[model samples]
Target: MEKELETTVCEERIFESLYRKLSKSIHDFLYYKYGSNCNPNDTTQEAFLKLWKNCDTVSPAKAKSFLFTVANNMVLNHLKHEKVKLNYQKATTKTHTNVSPEFIMQEAEFLEKYNAVLANMKEEYRVAFLLSKAENKKHKEIAELLDVTVKVVEYRVHKAFTILKEQLEGFSIK
Candidate 1:
């Protein structure tokens, strides 16, 4: 008897290929949608794990779509858990430094203001800003990652710079 043609993602080779091709995109999607607060890296891994767990049901052709949907839902569900967002934001804002107490206090105050301003900034501006500056992505790359025109990416980044400059008047990022 001849073996049946494999259609599902049960084959390790197929699964690996899908992973190599789609993982980065999925991670980027989650990051653009939720920022560091949602921990997009973890979310992407979980989405792939779900796909692997359901490999017998998910076809190779639909695997990409499945991963994206799973990741998006995972982040949304996580965001819905209220305290999780606050916890992540707080955790990220906290800092550990070996400087003098006065400097430490100043750093904490700056961190608090920075986090607060970021939290209040428009989501589009913040996302673009972080990706461009924190992540060190060029405008064209960010445009591609964000699925927008280069001009739009430039505009959003400019708006983000304006917000940061106004909000962090005395605090310079060196």
Candidate 2:
């Protein structure tokens, strides 16, 4: 008589197989979504652990979806928490730099002039400039957020800088 093969996939086998197959993809997903703010390795590990915990209910065919879903949710939660923390810090923090009265006054005047120039710039130019400079968003990201093209974002930002430079010709920050 011919012997039969064992076709049942147990939890341990699933963990080993899935870890090798899916861990890098999951890590790359988290890294691309969250950038450097989140630890993709840690998030990937947590996702795998959760998958192993619920392995009995999950099949190898469905494991990829399950892992991705878990990882995505965890990253979203982490980003939300980080936003809250950052908002709290911004609300409560104050700069305490020591400087002479003359330097402080010069700095304030420069800032006031800069703000006036920025405020007078075209709305689109100002928005692009601020998103690029203040928010540190990439041109591609700003373009996507504003529903414009990358070339448009680059042009607006450049125009804004040129306008500001001309408007603040005599002003210098100390």
Candidate 3:
């Protein structure tokens, strides 16, 4: 029991020494990589915690490199996850404007004509068309956000406009 206690004390001393020597550099590197979103202090604290957890595998000489790699990867993964969540929110928002009854009636009439036109379209073309026209997204931006090709976006938009123009030829402007 006494020998085990001494070994634990020695390990703690090694961790403390390594942290004092390398914490500042690790924090600076993370700050440069992640900018404002990654707090230096938080990353430094997390590094020390991780170092403590994996102390057996990390020697004092290599501790800073290990911490920097882990911190950088964590920040990148966080950013990627946030982008996906934001895109989902934007895609689900209602695109049509809402106002009083007069505007509502006009919108309903347009929707009826729009639906009839859309009903004949292939699913992919219909989705691209509605997302572009209703949401006002640019072709390239829509392509990137939807993971489709820009050419596909262009084709769908053109097809949808052709169908709408044909369907609404006799409809009066409200």
Candidate 4:
């Protein structure tokens, strides 16, 4: 007589099987979404850990979705906590000391000119330029935040640079 196979596997067995089957795929998915900044192995492990913890509620069939959801959330949380640091070097005229009147006047003048040019730029171009240069956001991130495409962001930023270059052609910090 042929014996019937088990319909329900034990939680441990199910977890192991899921891990073996989906870990690499989950890691690849997370890596693609988050780039190299996030450790895909760690995220994948954490996702499986969560699945194991909720094994009673999560079944083998549903584990893929659960793992992806957990991994995506982890990546987003990591991204949210990441800090973008910008190193700014101040431009100085050779003859002017830090506390010199000439330096202060030149800096103020440059700021005023820059502000004027930025104010006159189109809204979309200005937003993309600031997000890219000042905020240090990637084109993909900026596109998502602006609800536009990467091409649109690239186009706007290029247009902004063109306008600024034209406007500031004759203007210089002296």
Quick one: best TM-score, which candidate?
Answer: 2
Write the candidate numbers in order of decreasing TM-score. 2, 3, 1, 4
lDDT of 3: 0.76
Ranking by lDDT: 1, 2, 4, 3
Alpha-carbon deviation at 74 in model 2, angstroms: 0.6
Give Cα-based local distance difference scores for all models.
0.87, 0.85, 0.76, 0.81
Q: What shift in Å separates residue 105 of candidate 3 from its native position after superposition?
A: 14
TM-score for model 2?
A: 0.46
Comparison by TM-score, 1 against 2, better one: 2
Tens digit per residue, CA lDDT, model 1, 1-174 = 123344568888888889899999998888887898899889999999999999998877788999999999998898788677777777765466667999879979988989899899999999998998898999999998989999999999888788888889585554
TM-score of each: 0.45, 0.46, 0.46, 0.43
Per-residue C-alpha lDDT of model 4 across residues 29-104, encoded as one tens digit per residue: 9889888789999999998888777876765666789889999999888776664222223434387456978878
The residue ranges of model 3 lying beyond 4 angstroms of the native Cα positions read: 1-10, 94-174
Q: Please tell me which model should have the higher TM-score, number 1 or number 4.
A: 1
lDDT string, candidate 3, 1-174, tens digits: 565334431287777777787788878887787776867778678867877888777755667688888777777777898999999878866756657889789878888877877887777778888788778889999899789899989998887777677777554322
Write candidate 2's Cα lDDT for 1-174 as tens digits.
121123212557657878999999999988998886789999999998888778767767778999999999999999899899989888955667578889999989988989999888889999999999888999999999999999999999988888887888674322
